[model samples]
Target: MKKTLICGALLVFVQQMNLVQAQDWKPVEGKIMTEWTEKVTPENAHQEYPRPQMTRDNWVNLNGLWDYAIQAKGAAAPSNFEGEILVPFAVESALSGVGKTVGKDQELWYNTEFASPKKSIKDHVILHFGASDWETEVFVNGVSVGIHRGGYDPFEFDITSALKSGKSQVLQVRVWDPSDDGPQPRGKQVNNPSGIWYTPVTGIWQTVWMETVPSSYIAGIRNASDLESKQILVTPQVTAAQAGQQVKVSAWKDGNMLAEQTIDPNGTAKLTIANAEFWEPGNPVLYDLKVELISGKKVLDEVGSYAAIREIKMAPDAEGIQRMMLNGKFLFQYGPLDQGWWPDGLYTAPSEEALVFDIQKTQDMGFNMIRKHVKVEPARWYYACDKMGMLVWQDMPSGDMGNGWEMKVGVLGSQTDRARTPESEAIYRTEWKEIMDDFYSFPSIVVWVPFNEAWGQFKTKEITEWTENHDPSRLVNSASGGNFEMEGTKITGDIIDLHNYPDAKMPDPGIFGKENIIVLGEFGGLGLPVDGHVWQQKDNWGYQSFKNEEELLNRYAGLMKRLEELISDGLSAAVYTQTTDVEVETNGLMTYDRKVIKMKAAQLKPLHDKLYQVSVK
Candidate 1:
């Protein structure tokens, strides 16, 4: 009894010491932080399951404090680490606990230790990264596992072969990002961030986790739901399949199973529902899905997923003007241009609640759609949109700027495409395809925007056509207020979008409305910076600066009133300047820290309601 008491006391002492060590970490000071910042700690930093579309019950979140080091671009891994930086947050972000920059000439390295999660010889361990910047290489127990190049897409490595027979395993990551120094699709990152540009995010900026699966498992799932046919095509990508292996898919609603089908491991399962509930704004209905891999009578792997039945297309109204249609009806889509940046986390939100806060606030303001401007978000962001019934227009992050913009309305072939080198073109194509393929399963994504304002705009006709052909289910907006390539009577893509500031406007309905859907891609950048909730104290900016909330709301009301008129004039959709203030750009519906909503949702929803009432004829 005395020995048992002594062991219990020692266990409590070690627990207290671990608590003290975790408390030693702190966020870098001197920056505007959100309410969720305080909730973030080394022990709990985005501990939610990273992937929602394809999920398994058993997995481990690798988010927390990790040893970090910055060395020269070509230098070897450092023998000594600088300090403990929070995982999943970029090194330059305040939430990282190391607000230091890793430029083009330097490489950032991360080291961590995790216990081996192997249960048997047939188990294969996979390390998954939600996203990493530019270039990244992973090492398991000092063994090079894999190298991946792409800043926005998720990648994984099978580390089963690299594991050793031990309880603890070492994991190391090396990352190098040439932000603006290279010709990659870096969005708005610049070496000298000023004006519209913001800080650079290097290293991992998303969740890192691991899971053990059977040697042959379901690698991915693709759902193509057709509202017209009342059928959903389920395609499961299996990593390793034997001759007699088969896959089973079942769709459920509430607690009842609706449909089930089994097909060859390599085939697509087509399940038809007698009466399907359509997914749309204000009433997003998602059906649960269960996929199982089986060989004869034994089940190999099973995963939980979900799908929504919806469709978006363009059709002419009574006046022969093209209008964007959702679920066979015309609905004027309106939302903010969400940049997906956080004051504390930069590319990564402080927490999952913080990530969903922006979307909730936007929806509160009566917005139905969001133009996810240049930067892509973590998968959970889209998952929230799917659950909350918010439509998304995703953009390919722009890079290789300084390619002149000289397009004019009512002119054909007014601007020439930027002449990018072979290397630059290849990088853009590879990443864009990966982004589309990786994000194709989300039902909320209705439009795919390939270029924005002629920034790195090249081969407009070819790129737009490829995007449309690749994903015929989603409409293609060739360029949002960028150069237009007129082929015959219409623009290259389905939408002819225009971007005007401080006021609501649209592409000439008389000119482009008949051939394509006309939209005010961006407008009403009314800026009102709250006193204590800004990234910087001085020199804040907006397309149209406002003195106070009353002035901003009054001006915004005027813009909405005009937007209502344009809806009747063949305007199918519109996107406001932004959902939140980013860095020095003060033209947001909410302040940067999200502490203050510049204009209350109660006031904005009524004005937005009037826009939806306007006829599209």
Candidate 2:
């Protein structure tokens, strides 16, 4: 009787302890959090399909609670898990529910179980990760599948051979990230959070899912437009090609088939469009693509995609000054330096609606372009830009800070190139090429900014020439706001970019107008912080801060007036300081929480119209 009484008391005590722990669990509210923070839960976390470009209807989402543990680096997978963590969110993020920090010497381990979607020998279950930081290794049913190194690119492994014959399957992942300590493309992540640097995102920070495909399937596709030739290039890749296999590609507009062509599965197919419609800013026309792989008369696989017909080049304007021409016309591109970050979800956006909100808001503010500064976003973000007609100047995320940066303000100046280690150079080249390939399908991207302000700038001439040669479809800004290098006497890329603060300025027209298009790469950081929406009430800052919205608008108008004058002189494009308030930076038009818009969209629309209306002399 006494043993039974003691057991009952111990059970009651354990139940009470669990209740207390659950009550204590709350998001570590950053100084400011977004409205979406309140709505995020493990069941609904990033439920949307991740890969919009090459999508399949049948897939299983593995984003809910997962068993996680931090083990010493190089150690074997742990037998016991520390706790449950929300998948896809970083361990350091509040949304992750763990709120733990893993040092460089530690490895993050995630273990999850999923039921086999289709257990058949002919079907192959593919494991996909939208992105993960640094190094990652995957194991299925305790068998090693593959190892991937790059953090910012998507990777997958065919786990069919590793699966066991059972209803339940086991998945284990190991991740290690050194953040700023290592020489990789880490962007602005740091171990210690302060100033421009924020918290380091370790392990899986993107969607983790699985899809089942047949033995023979369509692997990938690359689409390019030839405006002058009036044809679209469609290159389809198949997993395994048969002797008489052919790939059929069709282009459709508004449910009407515009063109269709078939070619060898290994070759490039050209779909000719008579009197093709050129895609522009307001009317972002897209042609739907349907690709099917067939052997003899049997259809093996099919995939749905989309593309836009456009061209970006450098051509002389009326005054013999080089200008950035989009579809054979000079359209001045002006927008914000959009550093895609969120207060609640770092690296990953909280939700799909939250992901595209910035692009829509920027368009409403009368901007036509955006400089995706120093970071790459999910494919869905680029898809929104493609559908909404927001032209992007994608930047290769900056890293390897070992470079000796020389900031030059003149048109002709000497530049300092970094002596990168062979390993560092290889890492940079591999990641940059992967990023370019991953984002190539999105037509909204018109410019590729490889280096920003000499951050990891090396082999300037060689890298620039390589980028131009690889994708002659888009113009290459070898280094936006970077040290302009000269190949003998000429700039390497198509644009001469300059970064000026608070006031509008451009590269000297007299010096670079003849060879390259002159552009004000960055300017106008007019800041007005809302009372409750700041990262910190006391230490918030901007390039030029104001007390009220009226003053902020007035300062912005002044900058626009100066920008109009620069455009008349020879400026082809300009980028504002930022899109949103990041950390302690209060330079965004909107607040950090996205709860308040400091500048009215209605107020700035006409001012922007006036700048676009100015005709070059």
| RMSD versus native structure for model 1 | 1.8
Candidate achieving the largest lDDT:
1
Model 2 stretches with alpha carbons more than 4 Å out: 1-26, 409-414
Please report how far candidate 1 places residue 566 from its true position, in Å: 0.5
Clashing pairs in 1: none
lDDT tens digits, residues 177-249, model 1? 9999988899988878876789999999999999999989999999889887898788999998888899999
Per-model CA lDDT versus the true structure: 0.91, 0.85
Tens digits of per-residue lDDT, candidate 2, 1-617, equal: 99999999998997786565445545666457788877777668888888887778778999977889998999999999998777788888777778788978899999988887774678788899989998999999899999998888888999999988777899999999988888888888888877677778899989999988877888889988889887888888888677888898899988999999889988887888876888879989888899988887887778889888889999988788899999999899999999888877778787888888899999999999999998888888999999999899999988887766455545333468777889988999898899898889899999998888888788988888888888788899988876777754358999888887888877677777888988888888878878888777787778888999888888888998998898999999999988998878889988877889888889988888887888975
Please give the RMSD to the true structure for each candidate, in Å: 1.8, 4.6
